[model samples]
Target: MINSRKTDHLEICAQKDVESGNPGFDCIELDARSNPGADFKAVDTSTKFLGKKFRFPLMFEAVSGGTRKAGEFNKSLASIAQEYGLGFGVGSQRAMIEDKSVADTFKVRDVAPDIFLVANIGAVQLNYGYGVEQCREAVESIEADALALHFNPLQEVFQPEGDTNFYDLTKKVNEVCRKLKVPVIAKGVGNGLNLADVEKLDVDAIDVGGVGGTSWAIIESGRSGNGCRLFDDFGVPTVECLLELGELGKPLIASGGVRSGVDAAKSIALGASLAGVALPLVKNYFSGGAKAVEKWLSQFMFEFKTSMFLTGSFKVEDLRGKVLL
Candidate 1:
């Protein structure tokens, strides 16, 4: 199921634009040439995440642990992330947990030993027997700096083998938060983050996986034989989610439909601590290889720096409050 589903996701992505509603990058207007005196070469593109500094405030986002191809992709991507000083997130380790033989597939520590690595897992899967112990094992297995708990109800409802009984999830989240040594990040997969939903969670951060980026509902429709077609477009756009959840004050990760460095810069300008992107890279990488992925990512950094320079925002951290119109 994991292998097939992973492939299905990629196929669907290649066929069409699977992004949810407008992620809201368009709504944000970057402040123009206000500081004509600010030197472009002096622009600083560095920022910190999970207590570590990264050259760019960009995340490869989670999409891992399924097939041999997925594993190979992860290994190469992890190396590039480490070489460039960016954060890397492994896909769900559920497959490894269910079968130890597949563990090596998600093992990226060897390639990106020092990068800020994040372990991935479905939060709702906790209600079915997952616990703090499993979460610990996941982090330990990946040598991860933090653990990201993904909330993907929309996608699951469309999956034939979906488990929608999310009962006791909040209880489990708080329990795990108390016991885990690392920070717990709350992420909504293509559904956007809700402060109310996480009010009870002792999360260290939140990824506004709002809509306007990969509409999982649509992706599942292709796999589930159109059963989920009715709700193809759902959830709050990424931009709206960010603006709404930014008030909560938790470290925000803008994912969903973040396409370019300009889009990433837009997210940071509107309170995102870091921006996350996955779909575009997955497509490009599949068509090319590691170099393709690197070239594309390097472009993000270039555009991000260009955006910073144009806005006269010299620092990545200060962009949140100073650059957005």
Candidate 2:
């Protein structure tokens, strides 16, 4: 059954802490200052998402698929996204499209052939209507350039085999973004996507996935034992869902409970063009594997270039509305 719920969500997100005791990194704090005169060797982490190009705006959130230890934990997280240029997501390929021998658990883009892959699914599998060529054959089985779609109705209304028929889900995600070919991100599994649901989604970008972090309704109500204490303090917090979808303009990521690099430069000064971590890189990709997941992602890209040279900012679009106070 979907590879036994993807090995029961990686054995309840690895032996149950069920993560969500408000991990929204204390709702934004990065008035970072040490030497604001800039030039930590001219900080430039590089960017440019959906249309490709990236050196770091960070994204490796989706965690695991149907089995074979999630295809060897996505080939050691696609060799740490090919030695840390970053970008790689693979978890919910709906049990490798309902069993294709778990499709190599989720072929990590045939081993990181130029990163920036992303193709997880489940907006109730597009309201269980699955068309648009089955979401374009799950984005050509993972030559994905974009296709996240997660949204978890509070972990499917407190799971017990949850699916609660969310009818017409935003016009079936704007008809899978008008017949998908690429681009469709509409995440939120930690329950954070507001500003009236991002002004009623058309879809292109938006991850939010907020609420501190890992509270898939306290990890599916602690794997169905269901002692719901308000799913251990509910959602919408990652810097107030990135200041309510960074006042609408679009392109947003800032996933839930981000771990560091100054919580990814305070999620790019609260207007995130990117930044989506997953449970401390799945506990450093299951303990020191791909060179300990590239030494914990090069220590969050050297604390995101020392918080962009102490916030005098040097790139990544000069960190948008640059304001770490």
Candidate 3:
């Protein structure tokens, strides 16, 4: 299941018609040329998350893990994160918990010992009998700086092996947040999050994995052979997700369909602390390797800086309030 699951996700992402919904980056308009005296060269894109600083507010997000190939991907992705001084997340460690032999696959500390690594788990797994101990081992296994609790009910219900038991999940999240010794990020997988949902979560951060990026529903449906194509346009776009989730006051990760540095800029402009990209990074890395990823990151940073400078945002914070044109 581990290998097949990883391969399935990669293949679906590589070939399937999976991306859906409006990521919402295009709707925003950045104001130009008002601050003629603003220093373009001094515009800073650095951001702080979970106490560590990154060169840019872009994270690789969670992609794949739990197999040898996944481990190799993690190693390469971690190298990219380390090179760019950005944050990174390893895919879920549930496989490792179920079978200890696969634990090494998620352990990337040897390669990214200093990067702000995040350990991942499916929150629904708690209902399947996983508890705080498994969460602890997941973090320890990777020396992770934070833990991400993924909430993918949309994908869950569609999955054949879905665990629909969400009973007492909030209590479980609170337990993990209290005992896990690191920050916990409440995340949605390509489905938008709102203020009410954010309020219900007892997490320190919220990753509004909105629609318009990679649609897990499409992937799951394609795998099931029946498809949920009609619902492919479901969920809120990343921009709206960030705008809505950003209001709840938890540190924000603007994910889902952030495709470029400008998209990341738009997210920060809407009050997100950082932005994450997963599918595009996966596809790009798969087709191009490390150099491609690095080139893309470099271009993203350039576009982001260009956005800020054009909008008179001299620092990352400057882009927060007055970015819209």
Candidate 4:
């Protein structure tokens, strides 16, 4: 059953038309003409997130947990994070938390000792009274710098064995944030958070896992054969979500449908501290191995640098509020 489940994720992630048609990048354009002689060499991609400095404004978004393959995948991801000097997030740790025997599946810190890592769990898991101890254990088990509570009720609702009890989820999340020693990030799973929601949350950062990339609804529908077309197009586009949350005065990480450095640059211009890519990285990791993944990430960072140069912005902070063409 576990093997088949992993295969299902692998297949759908690798071969499905999961990206939304109207990715938010269309709504934003950088004023590249403003800097005809911009120096690309001076562009700085450094960012301070959750009290730690990252050499690049990119994070390896969460991807796996539940099997031996997951362990191998995370190890490779950790190595890449260390090599590129970026942040990394693991997939939902619920499976491993429930059974210590599979703990190694979520253990990537053993590989990248100095890289910033974020431990993940579903917001719904907090309602079960998992408490600070469990949250700490997840982070300690990983030696993570932060904890990410993923909000994927839509995906959960679509999955056959998904959890339905979402009562007091925000309160539970707030409690978790208050209790945990490390920073807590409220992450959306391809259904980006709006400004209103962001204002009400107590998380230190927000991962706008917007629509346009890896539609969990479509992925879940594909896995279940439920044929719910309505869900296929749900969630805000990455650019739009970034714009909405840009004024919220908190660090934001952009995800979902962010394919290139331009996309990453657009995200930064729209107010994202970092841009994260998951499905593309996962596919590369599975097919071409670590070297393939490293090559892809290096290209992404290069693209971001190019965008920064074109905008005449030498630092990530300089990219903020810059006029969009």
Q: Give, for candidate 3, the lowest lDDT window spanning 10 residues.
A: 29-38
229 Cα displacement, candidate 4 (Å): 1.0
What TM-score against the true fold does each predicted structure earn? 0.96, 0.34, 0.96, 0.94
Off by over 4 Å in 2: 2-19, 32-42, 46-54, 67-84, 89-100, 116-211, 222-225, 230-256, 259-262, 266-310, 313-325
The weakest ten consecutive residues by lDDT in model 1 span 316-325
Tens-place lDDT digits, model 3, residues 1-325 = 7568777888788766688888888888766666646677888888798799988888889988777878788899998888788999989888888888888877777877778999999999988888899998999888999999998888878878778887778888888888878999998789877677668877989888999999888898888775447778687788877777766778899999888888888888888889998987778777888788888888888999998888878778888765663
The lDDT of each candidate is: 0.84, 0.77, 0.84, 0.82
Output the lDDT of residue 289, model 1: 84
Which sequence of candidate numbers ranks them by lDDT, best first?
A: 3, 1, 4, 2
Residue 296, candidate 1: C-alpha displacement in angstroms: 1.3
**CA-RMSD of model 2:** 17.9
Q: Give the per-residue lDDT digits (tens) of candidate 1, residues 1-325.
A: 7767776776777667676577878876777676546788888887897797887788888887767877898899899888988888888888888888888888888888888898998998898889899999999987898999999887888889888988778988888889999998998778787767877788999988888778888788777776645566677788888888887888999998898898998898889999998887787788788988988988888898888887778888767665555
Deviation in Å, model 3, residue 10 alpha carbon: 1.0
Error of 2 at 12 (Å): 14
Which residue pairs clash within candidate 1?
Answer: 20-212, 23-239, 64-91, 192-210
